[model samples]
Target chain A: MPSRQRLWPIHVILAVGAAAMVAPFLWQLITSLQTTGETTSVPPHFLPSWQWSNYSQVFHDTKFAQQFLNSVSQTVIRVLAQVLFCSMAAYAFARLRFPGRNALFMLMLAVLMVPSQVYLLPQYQLVQNMGLLNTLAGVVLPGLFSAFGTFMLRQFFMSLPNEVEEAARLDGAGTFRIFWSVMLPLAKPGLISMGVLTVLWSWNDLLWPLVVVNDDSKMPLTVGLSTLQGEHLTEYPLLMAGSLLASLPMILVFLAAQRRITEGIALTGTK
Target chain B: MFRKALVLAGVGALALAATGCSSSKSASSGQADSGPVTLTYGIWDAKQKPAMQEIADAFHTAHPNITIDIQLTPNADYWTKLQTAAASGTAPDVFWMNTPRVGLYAGQHQLLSLSDKPGFDNSPFPKALNDSYTLDGKQYGMPKDFDTVGLWFNKKLFDAAGVKYPTAGWTWQDVISAAQKLNDPSKGVWGIASPDWTQENLFNTMLQAGGQAITPDHKKSGFDDPKSLAGLQYALDFITKYHVSPTAQQMTDTQPDQLFASGKVAMFADGDYDMPEYKAAAGLDADVAPLPAGPDGKKATVINGLANVIYAKTKHPQAAWEFVQYLGSKEANEIQAKTGTVIPAYNGLSATWVASTPQYHLQSFIDQLDVAVPYPVSKNTAAWTTPMQTTLDQIWGGKVDLTTGAKQIAAQMNAELAKE
Candidate 1:
């Protein structure tokens, strides 16, 4: 609402900040369209020569299509599973009165303190014992349940008015009915936020997928894109091109769900 | 970031080692009775995959019942994945092994000994390369390829400076003077790129100055030795005293190899593994010369090589051994040489590698074999090497003096080596 003349400094600062945020992405786009040599050339090549073949080279060298499909399926399964399972666990912890419930919730909360890497080997062995190595289920199973998600959703459920659940109960609804038809719909924002997080994490996870899956065809986009990297000499152009394509879907998803994510963050006070 | 992952993975490896997962139950034993055997050959370099595939195809042609499957894991995650798989007892049947890891794997009894295998001979490869894979007088790997350090200079930069090209017997003084002449700060061109690289820069100079990285017995740290400090000083002086090379910070921001490839660095000490990158670089006028001699009037280059090793628990040991033997054969070396992927470890085939790319005088790498020393290591090399690198980084950053940093490194390295 301030005058345009008086707001110039703030506008300039925001513009500068926005440019700083965008510079790396712009550089990536430029590099993606350059030749391998030009990417490493000194006096750095600012303008790209539009070497679009770098993108096609990614498909030729790796099972990009299969991996993309793998990533999509794995992410979809992980988000759905985490939402369903975490919400169920969260709902019980939030409203239900059970024996030693506080102690049980505390035990679940303790898991959030430990680093995930400490669990990598044991989880791997479990998956291996179950004969799930190199399978999509192996990658998705460990990620399906997260302590952070349960805790976040639990807080959201607690913040909701107890009157709504009581009204559902008065209508002859039980705990399961109240959770399914009433509490879940009320906690939509928390679920949406948790779902977004799981999608991002599952899409970008490298170490677990790299460990569980050895076959390139079964690898997700993250692991498949890594094969384009060489030990001593990586073709930066190809890597950049492939990375751009790999990130495009996430960017599109973010755009499509932009309003919902911000609204979810506003309602749940979580990001 | 990769180094951080390596340290984490190293901890994971230690945990694995502590567990002592010695159950070598052949996971693939059931497949032994099957008709065709597909042995997985794990490798890290994507650039050499084609040549490896060619060798595998040729081996398959020879042995109709054996098929070799090449598994390419990029180097960054290779060791981590290998250790995880090893713990789970699903490691590849055969895989590429490097000098740093040979001792660790062999000591852990994870690698199969090739010494008593029929038709397995180390005579064709250099003794230094062969010795790298040997522990307790037992051969565990077949030498596949070797890479020696060379002084790669930008020809156009040398011409612009009106300096003569480096040759076979150039001394350290000659290198200093040439670097000084070629250094042009205004043009953003450095006389050299002297980053704290152990294999390419520091190790070569350390050896040239009559210093050993580790004792022959691999029981103590040699960084405390005065001769080794002298060699490191020679490389360190380039940045601190002469200012001919880029600052360590600059090199970190932009890798020294990238600097050299872009023609910003006049001279770079690197290995043949970098040749493909340089060859592919557009408008890069570069060629190699033997690294300069040290103050002791003797030349030395740290020679490192990769070897093909089979997993101890491989179900199809016979087929794996046959494939490994073929991989080490003259014919397979020729295919590798023709592709110019690496200097084939087999003696007398280096000429083919030198001739593979006629543009550069790669023979300089070959000629240095006479004075090449094996890359140094202990049972757990990374335990000491990682600390050595940290101290060197501080020294290069001008945060610590050479004497203090060297002594600190020596103390730490000795402590780690003693544990090993």
Candidate 2:
């Protein structure tokens, strides 16, 4: 155990830092319950007007329920695809003895270096050409494969002890068997880390969905909440309320899986 | 093998569903299909959304076979979304367009040519706006509404200082004299908020000084001209020399409108669009008046407006055109005008809009229309304007002299103009 007084100062510093991070979110919650006039008041009003109707207005003014469904379906499908596809690719690079394996892996690593915007047009074209525009699958298609996840999982797989793979090979286990059954169970932390990131990225993804879907029914929450923001003026109270409700699922997801998330974070420190 | 067959069946079903969707990709455009058709109309203004929705409902009642879906992507993201969607041929069937972006969109053939359409009419709109929307000899959009800049002052602050309310005949000299008396730092109030903006601030003043933002030819910038440099300086002098306006840093931290709403600024040079919002501001008493005359004894205001345009690649071009025509129709403008939502672009609808909000003397916007200068643009305004804005920012921050900054902008803008 550490000395109480020595650790006490460090604890105080961390607590303050934690509060700083939480303050904005707390302010968002308070602002969501405020009136339009109260929210914009100078010298800053701390107490809210308790205008709870702001939350109801978001539902009434926009197709928030449908958008919430779209976000969920897209994110779940995207996360499942990333986990399954990335783990397989990472396993192949880690354990397989295929021709051009090193070259293929390097090319994927290069994909991570170039900015994502460079591929936005081309990716959109490919999805559009597939006749998936305005469909839920269109938004999920591009996010399904991620180079960062493959690289992170590959590094984790490489760091694992070689004895397990050698033992499995001696028992005449095939590469698929080793990857899916033997090594996969051990890569749980890496998979969890990738899953958490994919969910976060896909849930909040706005630009791709905004471009792909024109109908209000198929839009994600980020795009739906955007309607509350107009050209000249915005109703801040309504926007804050819509966003708070839209962000609740993600917040709950992060809190419920926080311990596993922290442990997953430890395995592959890079996001 | 049985499980494999099941998996294959699932994949086959997905492929069929994809084909079903792709086949209907032309459904929004092609009248040959004869089924119920839906068209997407994209817009950016949140304040005008309810009225736009009402217009759409009215249109739907008349054209029962056609359904219009409204998509609002705030102005900030509207273009980026449009560009991406246009590249993939999935842009909204009809959308709102402004002057600067009109040239870019039309040049890329992203917008439909409205002139050749059967019922297309530009006679109702101002000739300047109609010509502004034309690019490469093709008219692209129909004007939806227009807005002009005005001097919006806090009546309470004017009364507190025992100063007379601004009249239409007021000059720039009158503004400086009144601002000096109204500026009270001890009470956290500034006389004006003169942020370095093109539309509502510097550009209009430049025209008042007999200077154009870009030459009529659109091949070069007019900022390097002596008269234009003086116009830019006059707006900046309120902060640097007169000390009556908020500093550039403060204006950046707090928008001019926010300061005005809080009763911290006596005057803010804003557009006609903010009239409705000002009416809703609790404690602040505000009204509009024409911009003061410049040294040249001339008054000018920057006139800009949104237009309703159709995507060139829309599957339902005929339906989309009907909706666009209706949006610019007198009936649709009346619905928007009666609510004081916007100054309808139609010729005779201004009076109704003026009466809708009787409290504010919004006729100042109409009264200045004779002296309104068209919002400047070229085939690629962003290419020049983006850099021009940055160079102007340096002057605003006191890093460069106003004349030197304008010259720098002219050099960069001229180079960008040559490329187009």
Candidate 3:
């Protein structure tokens, strides 16, 4: 009886937290359907007539499909590259025995302490020197490697026992074989977590993409959405509708991966 | 060894895929494809795309050997993006420039000087408009258009209240009396929808009262001057003492423009750019008049203009300059005027612009240009405004008195100006 009573408060707290987190998205969805006059009405309208054509209008007004494709391509390539490269680097730092391995690991971790802006100007110059301005490669190259992912995976790998890898090595498996066949599958939680993070960051990145890409046709959804905001200043309904559409992909990703993400977070806590 | 080979193959495939995706098909506007030539024109407003395309078509007709690509970036992101492009030496060949940002770009030498460019003439532009874009006796941009602030009133509201419509030479006292007479609180209407604390909006009023926002040398604060303080107090009195304007909180909840559009306010003081929007949204007839004069009996309006600038590092300088010249010409101005997008800076184009939009009286904008003072600005305008606006907010919110706020802003402005 006492346990049941304690559980009720926990359930209530969770319900409230979920509602609070979801309210803004719901508001965005509702506001997107409103007319401009309805949006500015005094006391504010909570419900609005569904203007489904706004979804079609967003595509008609701007190069939404092209930008969406750009964002998807950039984000997918960036996330996949980060997962593979970071996992390998983390494997080397966690399991490999080599000269100055600890020092190299420390140097990699040191990069995470510096802010991102310090690298912006130099990185921009580097891209410019390479003649990659206004190109998708420039947007993806800077994010292809992530020190945070390396550090995260290294910590996760360090927490795992060596018995599983040793067994594979004892069976005549080489270092690469052990890492690829034995260890990576075991590091699924960490990889999943990092993959989600990489996807989220790359999908919503604005500043770096803004610097690299000049052509509107090459712009990602974030930059494209902002342009829509400025061009359609008085058309709040359309802006809101565009914003709602832009956020849908990220929301759907989170929803689909929520279970794995929660499990990863719980594992992270224990680690 | 096989696993390692597999990983290497994967990396190679990824690199190949990335390379394939990075390739962009370049679009050219001219017939010539032999030489190293690509002219990029940067514009801030997408609404002006049709006009820009027309200009580009005209330029292409004249010089078929040069390609011009119109690049549109919105206003808020334009400067930051341009700065990034400037730092990387890949900025568009030619771009739209604004007065507030001209000094910084010119001081940095990021803009191409246009004073000696062929087919360039400065005499057609008014002296007041031309002076804003000139830096150190060298011109970086041709004055493409001009704008001035004015009080836009709803004629239907005035007629309903039996109040006389404001004319060209109305005083601040006249405005206050008319506002008081027209005000009916119970009907959810106010006399004026005063802008919430913009130096651009308030400075003209202070200047009309024989005060300035900054010292003559642009090194000190003029906000602390008695006349400037009186102007601020008068703006505050509309909400506090007179109760003829919405409270600070109400203004915050809904912007003054939204309030005015909803017919809650009888008058709104803003630029001519809002004329089309007001006519479209506010279902009542509207008219414009010069900003009311203060006790000194001299009316002042803030004058600002936009320019087309060529980037310093453009690969096709000649072609870029041609496009810039075309955008600044009377032909492009006529297109803009007919669209009613803004009052074209060309001297005689106001007639066409005013005629294009009949719902609102746009002649007041042209008249105010005669007495309009340039917006007080410097290379470090943003730095000074940050602190000035914060202190002004406190005064408007009634948290501090006007004198104290003005003093604080003046001290802050001087410190910032010294840095500049």
The top-ranked prediction according to DockQ is: 1
Pairs in steric clash, model 3: none
Model 3 C-alpha lDDT per residue in residues B1-420, reported as the tens digit of each score? 111122232232222233232222112322234564668888766666777777787777777777678777766556656665676567788887776667766766667778867667887777777777877788888787887888888787899899999988799899888889778898888999765445336887788888888774566778889998877777778888888999888888887766776677898787776664566552546788878988879888878788888776666666677777777788878878887777777888899998987766788888877777776767656667666766777888889887888899888888878877
- Estimate every model's Cα lDDT from 0 to 1: 0.88, 0.83, 0.76
Worst 10 residues of 3 chain B by lDDT: B1-10
Error of 3 at B244 (Å): 2.5
Best first by DockQ, ranked: 1, 2, 3
C-alpha lDDT (0 to 100) for residue B42 of candidate 3: 82
CAPRI quality band, candidate 3: incorrect
Docking category for candidate 2?
A: acceptable
How many residue pairs collide in each prediction?
Answer: 0, 5, 0
Q: Could you give the candidate ranking by lDDT, starting with the highest?
A: 1, 2, 3
lDDT of 1 at B116: 68
Cand. 1 Cα-lDDT = 0.88
Q: Which residue pairs clash within candidate 1?
A: none
Q: Which candidate is the best by TM-score?
A: 1
Worst 10 residues of 2 chain A by lDDT: A35-44
Best by lDDT: 1
| Model 1 stretches astray by more than 4 angstroms | A1-7, A263-271, B1-9, B23-34
Q: After superposing candidate 3 on the true structure, give the runs of residues whose Cα lies further than 4 Å from its correct spot.
A: A1-16, A47-50, A98-103, A231-234, A264-271, B1-36, B155-160, B215-220, B280-286
